[model samples]
Target: MSVAIVGVAECDLGQTGKSVLELQTQAVTRALADAGIPLSEVDGLATNGISRFSATQLADYLGIRPAWSDSTFAGGAVFEMYVARAAQAIEAGQCGTVVISYASNQRTARSRKMTGVFEEGTPEADFEEPYRPLYPISYYAMVAQRYLHTYGLGRADLAEVAVAARAKAQLNPAAWTYGKGPLTVDEVLEAPMISSPLGKLDCCLVTDGGGAIVLTSQSRGVEVLGYGESLTHTGMATAPDLLRTGAVDSGRRAFARAGLTPDEIDVVQLYDSFTISVPLGMEALGFAGAGEGLYADKPHNTGGGGLACCHPGQLGVLLLVEAVRQLRGSGGERQVPNARTALVHGTGGIFSSHATVILGVS
Candidate 1:
């Protein structure tokens, strides 16, 4: 049986002052409605495992009696992993229809402190967290600095990534930064530096949003051509190579399974936790040669990505929503011309984990 993404929807982007649960329910409901499938048909559910009993709590709140459920936690890439798992379940006859959702109130709740350093007794606490090297921006900054040094690239190269994302956001009215104005490379370079090479614009916004995707056995909508995931390391400090990420292995697996090449992808939706991640992902995904990733110059993150759109803690679901819209030719002004295939890549845990999915109009 072939699995397909039948529906994708995102809750209102930006700050909405809504609870995480409320956003999750709204997104799931909207996705179900978009799929034209009744809630009763949803036999499987998947979501983040942040909460100890999140799966059961969500199932009960939505009044669902799912036969199978997954609350796997892999950071921002969790949703992509969920989609891959849902497909496997359907193929194995463990479930029929599955729904994957994500919601976060990082902006409204101001939960930055919750993510501070690792737990007191964890391995990271002893060797990494004490130095504060694992904080989100700081970790990414370290990676950025290494990438820049290795590739002989400077802040200007990174600025292009932010500029491109903002340009795309200008075409997406729903984007959080849309209509505010387009971002210039100079402006991005001149912005306050959050961490050495990463200016304020280099980081993604902490917005509140939720998204959901529905998958089914019938390959009617955007078909799932292939999916792959990899976990190279748990923390940046432990990574064997700073410039290389799990995307290399995951993208290789996905493209091989789909029998497609990087050039064949009509659009790309890569997790943009920071500006440097784009070029690194491009290179790792085979879209660009090593040290030449910044010059790939392809249409990426068409919905502005987390950079100019909304990050909301986790963003894999939103990436799928945008990719589906592009494939459906419903991406409004941000639509890629004649888009037929899209490759969405999600990263987690300071470039430790990765999930890649290839989608095409069926």
Candidate 2:
């Protein structure tokens, strides 16, 4: 009944000009190879960003008939949720080996645009879509504004997060902003504004990339020690508290299930869709006190994260890839010292969806 991540990998990062299916194939095959398991042995598949029938389409393209498949779409949090589901299926004897993956050509195809998180005839459409505000960003920006105002913090306080992420990316050769030189607080503050306090530098990299992770109950690698997920709302219009999110609930459940606490985790890989996401995630996960995570230095986002690293639409799957590498002690120059356990948190859809996964050596 124990589930473990046997292998994890990412395909061509940056602008690959490849289709989503092509990127998905590359990531999946490479991950399978890493696990020393052939594609024929993969009877489970979980993926999205391909088509409406995400899992079904990828299964046919890979020429495999999976006994179990999942295509849950909740933005970046989907992959972590998929890991939870895949582990359950393996434990239930529904599938033996599961391959969870995701890929996006948002940068190459220039399709990373947002009107709203709602469809026609929905409450969001009637109430929030008429103003023509850029969603996701605008929603997060509103939260950022509220958070800063609530705590009497300034924009300079958030700039530290971007500077720190860029520094970490410098240590990771695979990061998009690696070797781009060191970033300064002033530079981040001076960057062109995207949505109020969040400037261009405060955002994540837009790139073409994909990643995958292979899981099994054989216990050959990092174990899925704990997991949790939550959906507070679909759109920001109905969101109750702009500063508080479901990450608190998800992270608490994960820690309680893992029999561990934030202090025990040696490494962290929270989805950094924007600079604000990091501090907010830290506070939500109890790594720091209320309104204090922004300045708290912790072992987090060693591979630059979505800010300096390649962000292919959804960054959840890649978070697992980075965490696995760190846990395996294969982090090279960016390897954390005496690292044993790692925590990964992903947020999606303007902080509407959340997932937290705790990983440790099997």
Candidate 3:
């Protein structure tokens, strides 16, 4: 069965006070309304359970007791994974409409605690909890270091990605860093290093926000086209080459499932938690050849991305939302004209997990 995203919605990001539950409900309601569907019609609901409230409780609050409700946390990619799962459920006739949501208050309610101390070695130690090795910035910095050494990539090249994304962000109002246009490569390079070779601009902004999307079978809406997922490693340390990520495996599988090639994709939504993530995703998605992986002139994350656009806990959901909007000819300035096919990529599980979704207008 084919599945198409019928509606998408997101609550105001970059603020606190609204509980995760409230934000989730707001997005869900807006999505349903956008699709012209009623809450009583929802038969399935999926969301992450890491920071937010329980799905069971949220379901009750929304007055939706879905026959299929899941609270899965594969990290950032949880929302896209939910979309893939919802497609299968719909194809199996288990659910008619599935609502996937992600909401977080990273700024106010849940601030990241950074002690800058980590205890390495085995997990049996008493300080295992406090000493969690390197944080995400450090992890990506290591990857950035490897890329610089291996590919002769410079800090300026990495800054290009940020500059490009911020440029796009200026064109989008929903983007958190909008109006903050054209961040120069020099400035990015000069920015304080979050980790060796990784500057503050290289890191994603932590903001409070939530987003959600509504998916239904093709007969009821649009066709899902193809979806694929692959994990490079269980842990970040086990990754063989952080510069070139597992997005390739995931992208290839998604393309094969869709019976399409990278050339067929008109727009791409690569998970851009950091600038390096863009090249990593581009390489994996076959947008650029191996070792020659670079972003294309084709429309990519025209809505800014997690960099400029607010990347709440459920940021990947926003990617799917934008992809669907563009494919449906609804994206205004950011729309890729005549774009019939779109690729939405998500990463999670300590960068070990990667998921890709190919959507086409049927």
* TM-scores of the candidates in the order shown: 0.96, 0.97, 0.92
Ten contiguous residues minimizing lDDT sum, candidate 3:
114-123
**Candidate number with greatest lDDT:** 2
**256-293, model 1: which lDDT tens digit per residue?**
98889999999999999999999999999988899887
Q: Which candidate is the best by TM-score?
A: 2
Query: Global lDDT of each model?
Result: 0.88, 0.90, 0.78
Model 3 segments beyond 4 Å from truth?
50-53, 113-133, 218-220
When 1 and 3 are scored with TM-score, the better candidate is 1
lDDT of 3: 0.78
Model 3: per-residue lDDT, tens digit, 160-237?
888888888887888888776579989898999877788888877788777778888746555688888887765455
Question: Which sequence of candidate numbers ranks them by lDDT, best first?
Answer: 2, 1, 3
lDDT of 2 by residue, 125-186 (tens): 68778876676687778888888998999999998999998999999888888899999999
- Lowest summed lDDT window (length 10), candidate 1: 111-120
Which stretches in model 2 have alpha-carbon errors above 4 Å? 113-116
